[model samples]
Target: MVSAPLPASALPQDSKDRLRLWIRLLRASRTIEAELRERLKQQFDTTLPRFDVLAALYRSPEGMLMSDLSRYLLVSNGNVTGIIDRLVSEGLVLRARRNGDRRTSIVRLTRAGSEQFRAMAAAHEGWIDELLGGVSGNDTQRLTAMLKSFRSNWEGRE
Candidate 1:
């Protein structure tokens, strides 16, 4: 036999409220992410991870090591490698081994890749604005600041 979980009433009021907030935040994030994923697929035939990779590379015009890219994205090297492989084949990115370090490679966006990402990024911004139209600019700023503080509070605990 298995034990039953505690009832919501058993939780302290503050705990319950925090739990509710977490759920609301998670649901909003998932809903927005799903919508963006669908829009990206329909509009650009791309995935969010691919867009993320491109965005990172675009920010670093020179290039980044594969390990650095993976760390920056908070993903594993293998995941970044697969995406880099695809991007390389598409001619959207170039990967060259670091000098004197054949095992490590630096990745950067090609001219065409930069152009394509710029278009996608502009559209992405519009989509986000449309989706989050209900939030006022002031509210967006407040919420962003609060979230940033929250993240800072919990940073590196994991």
Candidate 2:
């Protein structure tokens, strides 16, 4: 993996650009995630994974199963259990075993949790805006479009 960091022009005709893009994406994600975590921690005493679960639940149409939350949060069931336990203890989330399905538990953001998520989301939006605000609307749109295209292409899905 320590091959020469070949110049763009020096890269193989086919794979160079994509490799460069992947490198940039990984670096950018790490930087942004670190920054967001710091900001969220300072403002809300929340970790990124916690925020992610809340955000996912906040968007669920009618709450969500623990399994779904784990998948959406990209975490393991045990990890989700830890998070859910903490959230429940904080009165930020409530879990109920699905009717006729004792093995399946549904999790929902409590009133307090929903309010907290809203507040955090507002601040988060502002932070993101502050971080990317320098870019013009046109550029932002173009970037989104490009990213969407890249994702679709990479995933081989519509």
Candidate 3:
């Protein structure tokens, strides 16, 4: 059994305000992410992780090593391997052994993959714009800058 947590009114003013800000940020993030995931599934028949993988590969036309892809995506190699396997099977990506290193593989988007990703990306941008339309451009810029600053200040702080 567990007791209920204290209400927000019990906290000090500053603490309460910070808590509220955190909650709002989290809620907004989750809402947007859920919307994006649903849109991706419905419109593109894809998942966010898959879109992310394709986006990363699209940025690096020359290709990326499997290890590098995992690192860049901040996911484990096994997770990446599964997604890569699916993409390869779908003819959307190619995986080839690196020269002089049979143990390593490099992955890149195929021409078909690149074209498909471009289309998806365009629709994604439009969806995001529509979703965030309530915020003015100035507010968006200010909020973005504040978030960047917050991340910069807190990152690697443990």
Clashing pairs in 1: none
Highest-scoring model, lDDT? 1
Q: Scored by Cα lDDT, where does model 3 land?
A: 0.97
Question: Top model by TM-score, which number?
Answer: 1
Task: Encode model 2's per-residue lDDT on 5-102: one tens digit a residue.
Answer: 77778768668778888899799779888999999999898999899999999999489999988987778999999999999999999999999698
Cα lDDT of candidate 2 equals: 0.90
Runs of candidate 3 exceeding 4 Å displacement: 1-10
| lDDT (tens digit, per residue) of candidate 3 on 100-152 | 79999999999999999999999999999999999999999999999899999
Flag regions of model 2 displaced more than 4 Å. 1-10, 156-158
**Which lDDT tens digits does candidate 1 get at residues 3-105?**
8978999989999999999999999999999999999999999999999999999999999999999999999999999999999999999999899799999
Model 2 TM-score relative to the real fold: 0.86
Question: Candidate 1: RMSD over Cα atoms?
Answer: 2.2
In each prediction, how many residue pairs overlap at the backbone (N, C-alpha, C within less than 3 A)?
A: 0, 0, 0
TM-score of each: 0.94, 0.86, 0.89
